[model samples]
Target chain A: MAQKVAILGAGLTKFMRRAKETGKELAFEAARMALEEANMDISEIDCVVMATAPDMFDGVHMKGDWLSDGAGAKRKPYMRSYVGGGSGVFAIIHGWYLVASGLFDTCLVVAEEKMSSCMPHPQGAFNAIYDQFLERPLGVNLLWIFSLEMMRYMHVHKISLETIALVSVKNKRNGLDHPCTQKGIAGEYTVKDILNSEVIAYPVYRLMVSPVTDAAAAIVITSEHEAKRRTDNPIWIEGVGWCLDTSYWTNRDLYYPKYVEYAARMAYDMAGIKDPRKEIHVVEPYDPFAYKELHHLEGLLLADKGEAPKLLEKGFWDRDTKDGIPSCPSGGLLGVGNPIAAAGLMKVIEIYLQLKGEAGKRQVKREVKRGLAQAWGDLMQVGTVVILSK
Target chain B: MPFKEFIEKLSKAKVQKGDIPVWHLYTLGIGGDVFYKGLKEGKIKGAYCEYCNSVILPPRMYCEDCFEKIDKFVDVKGPFIVVAYTELYRDLDDNRLDIPIKVALISVPYAKGGIIHFLNPYQEIENGDIVKPVFNKKRVGSLKDIKYFELKK
Candidate 1:
């Protein structure tokens, strides 16, 4: 039988707008933190799983290989997996499988994105996402997709702009307590501030969008036996699931996520989560866009169809709200920063911190025995989910 | 100039004036070459796979069905409808271009693919607008040779 897998340690550099550190330096800092947290030496790692969104963001090709040294691969087995924004969580799930399959005793998972290198604007990199023939010609920008989706979500759920704007306000406010959060705006915020922000796309304002960031995160995964020896509170990897939908984005429904449901089904089945809404103590759905959080909340079975917005209005997603579900207590990509791959890993790290009671000011008040983290990406075509338990 | 001064000057130049490696990023013609070439002659061209019998616009390198390479090119006079397009406020350099450019997707009939090109007269062009390619006589045999596409009506 294959061994069970557990997260030994996790580390992250302060997610920032523009760090003085080079890409390699950021990776090294995060890697060093993870290794030190594990109380293990670099040589102890058997394999390295490096996750990064695109070479364009870093202005370097084959970034996994370029970052091999900083990620601690160094001739050890290493591979790269990319499903756009889901790259980080995907990397961790891959690490889990590696350890569970008995292929490696210890694995180092690294996720990094250096958006600062994309000159003029990171938006230039987004132009490459469209189909050159069908979509590129339409002058389709990245925000348009999110805006359209948010519009559909609003229409379907009868959600007001204020309700959606609350997500941005809440996460940014919550992020103030997270030291590593890049865009954690301090002080109180109002829905009016969000409404007054520049309209990057219809229904999606500037504040609702996560800032382009440069950061790195790393996690160490080990076999169950090795984890027990390394740390007293190892977070066990209960289940992992990832799925990709068709590339023909226009043919599918934008308001709902079918792929995320498929992925959640696979993960929930494995994690014995017959009732995700009741079972999973904490949830971290991808929030590259504000509506995405609600969209994915429904997809993860955390709420009934079109009920996420209402649940949010009722304070269901609040860390201290009486409704009792803590979502994105780490402030999420909405509050922190969206460095593509690193954003997903940051979510995973949040689960780790919460389970260990290390979340400090942003910590949830409830007992978090089981938690789930998910990352969605790729023209909104990919979904990755992982369930963890202490 | 002294060897030291010459070497120093060359190294400090804006884009490796003398001895550093450089690579140019071109939308290479390997796969889309024919689709681009046909435009130079004011014609829209596409590739049809003999095996799969699929007429691929945007002149694909291989058939989506058979996955076999389709190197043959064919021409089509277009009343190609606009599928999608964007109006840009800035150029590739982040500096505003003199004329606001309308980039669009032109869906050609009887082909599996569409051509991405510039749509001139931005205010008038709308989705589903039929347009024809306009070739630049000075720059034939390349994708850029086609100056821009204009509304057919």
Candidate 2:
């Protein structure tokens, strides 16, 4: 049997449009802060795992090798793992196996991105991720594909744009309390603001999308025995799961995220969760776009397909609502800024903090014992999930 | 399947060639900004790593050896030593050039890493020979500002 694993500490850098720090420096800052919070030193770590999105974004090849020293891996065992945007949450799953399998006692996981390095715009880097022979020939960017997904979802569910816009208003409002939220991205905004915002690709408004950002986030995880010896407030990693759908997204129905459902089912099975809607208290689902929150919520089985927007209108996903499950209380990618891989890890860190009662103003109203953080990416095919409990 | 049939089937498959239509605008990060700006001023600079007791060329924000933050940058006046040299008869696109271009990995004195730049075609160069950078008259904050390196008198 495998030993249990637990998160010891977490750290995050402020999300911004452009950062003066290089990718290495950003990784170092987050790693140093996480070590400090864990009351540990570089020498105490047994291994390190790094996660970052495409090399095109940073304009560097083999960026993981370049960032090894900054992540405190110096001479220790180190490796990089990636599944595009899903890398952040997947990093935690990777670290869990390192300690759970008794291969290492402690692991430091870091996710960083400098999307601003991709000149003109970071969206261009996303263009290169498409299928070369088929998708690339169509000259499709991220917004175009997401617009298709959003349109399909709304059409099948018969959801109004107003209901979808509410996700943007709620998440951005929730982000006002996040110290690391990107400037100008988070604040109180009305649904009308999101509806009237510049339409990048019909149905996908500017205000509804997460901004391009540069940032890093890190967490320290250890074997349950080591965690018990280190801190009294260790958050256990109850379950972890990930899945990837076929790369030919054109063949699939965009109305639902079956990949997320498959991943969530695997995790819920491992955690012995029979009823996610009632058992899971808080969730931080990937919400790079407003409609994605609802799309993912349905995929995670927290709501019936097309039922998430209805839950949102009832104030069920608000941060302060006692009778509701708070979603994206950390402002999510919509308000917190999306630096690809780091955005997913930020969600994991939020769940860790909320469980420990360390989330200053971002904590939910109801008592929470278990929470889930999920990330989706790679042509909208991959889903990574990590379940944490106090 | 027979060899002729397999070849015929393969020939019938369609192949498409395309390019990634994206341009990058990279920010010269913390240390790179200092190093590149110094080049524009007709100077060479390297970041000082106190723990490693060495200066690293192409200055970076952190020392790879000691893994410590590097905050000090010092001028590097060098009789650069040629570590290696290569002559290319073709350009990047594989087109024949009018004259072969000589490139060398030139190491600075007391610095950990070195810069690779064009070696003056007119000068006779060999490994371990001393050289110095000849700056461009109209300097830009780019690697191109260093026109080439010539043999030291």
Candidate 3:
């Protein structure tokens, strides 16, 4: 059996639409914060694993080597891994192995994205992701696929625009409590407001989307003995799971994410959790879009298939609910700006802080022990999951 | 704080610049030849997986879910439904669009995927609206062969 691993520290930078810092600078900032919080020096990190999505975003190739120094991995054993947006949680999984295998006493994991570096519009960089010969000629941007998925999801679930809009309202409201909340609007907005917002795509309004951002986040994980020696409080990694569906997204049903379910099952099994709805206390599932929270909630099996929209109507996934659970109390990518990989890493950081009772104003009202964080990326292909317990 | 002097000194540092200047040419793979040829003939070719008894739009060589090789080609039965639509307020440069291009996701009935393209009509386009492909008089084996999908009059 692999050795147990624990998170010594976590760090996050406030998400921004644009940052003066380069990718390396952002990585260094987050890494420095994490190391400082752990009361550990950069020299102690035995290895480093960096996660960032798309070279296009940073306008750099061989991003791992370029970012290594800023991530505090200068002349240290280092590598990078990516599964598109899923890289955040996937990096955690990679770091866990480094410590769990006893090959390294500690590992520093960081995920950064700088979408602003891509010229014209960051959305244009996504053109390379499409089928060069077929889908490329359609003049499709990233939002078109999301709109297509939203339309299909609504059609299959018989979902209403009102219920979907509520997700935006509640999440943005939750954002007010999170220090990292980056939704640009200064005041409160309602479902009616969301309904009246500019319709970028039918069934998807401007309010429903997560803004592109430039940001970074980092975490330090150590072996059990090292964790005990390093800090009085160490959040335990109970389980980790990742799964990837074929990239041919057009061949799969858009209404449900079977891949996330597959990943959730693996993590839950490792955690010895047979019932996620009852066993899990908090969630920070990827929510780059408002409806995505519902979609991923179902994928996590927190709600029944097509049942999230109805339950959301009853405030089931609020930060504290008499009948249900708290989710994305950190504001999630819906309210927090999305810098792709950093957004996902921030979700993990949220869970860690919540479990540590250091979440400040965004802390859930209910007592929490175990929490789950997940990320989805690619053509809805990659699903990465991590379980943390206090 | 002498920041101005520091800035001037930093600006004098040598800088190096380079560009890849590479272009990519991608083949549509096994299933693409038939599909593009059909496009030139003003027909939308869809892949039929006999094993799954289903058809996929924008055709592929295999069924991603079932992992079955798809060798059969079929014309997507139309009166395509406008499953979704969007109006773009900004272009690639993030500038507000002058005429606000209308794009629609049109699907052949019961197909798993659909084609995303510009729509001819600017207003009153709703989900479930029946649409027909409008082909150009001059044929080219490309997506532009069909100018746009128009609501069937």
Name the top TM-score candidate.
Answer: 2
- State the lDDT of candidate 2 residue by residue for A1-390, as single tens digits: 889899998889899899988888888888888988998877789999999999888777899888787788888989897999999999999999989999999999999998987867888888888888878888778788899999999999999999999999999998999999999999999999998899989789999999999999999999989999998879999999999999989899999999999999999998999999999999999999999999999999999998999999999899998978899999999988999999999999999999999899998989999999999998879999999999
Clashing pairs in 2: A119-B25
What number of clashing residue pairs does each candidate have, in the order they appear?
Answer: 7, 1, 0
**Candidate 1 regions off by >4 Å?**
A183-187, B1-153
lDDT of 3 by residue, A1-390 (tens): 888999989888878877756676678778878888888877688899999998776667788778776787867889897888888889999898888889999999999987876776788777777776567667677888888888888899999999998888877877777776664822368889999989988889998988888889999999999999988879999999999998788999999989999999999999999999999999988888888999999999999989999988898888867657788888888777788888888999999999999989888888899999999988779899999998
For candidate 2, give the lDDT of residue A206: 91
Least accurate 10 contiguous residues by lDDT in model 1 chain B: B15-24
User: Residue B83 CA error for candidate 1 (Å)?
Assistant: 57
Per-residue lDDT tens digits for candidate 3, residues B1-153, read: 555654458768865442322232323445666778898998999999886688888786655434345679999868699999988889899999778888988997878788888888565677899988989999879888989888888
Candidate 3 structure lDDT? 0.84
Instruction: Supply DockQ values for each candidate.
Output: 0.01, 0.48, 0.01
Going through the candidates in order, the fraction of native interface contacts each one reproduces equals: 0.00, 0.54, 0.00
Model 3 lDDT at residue A354: 92
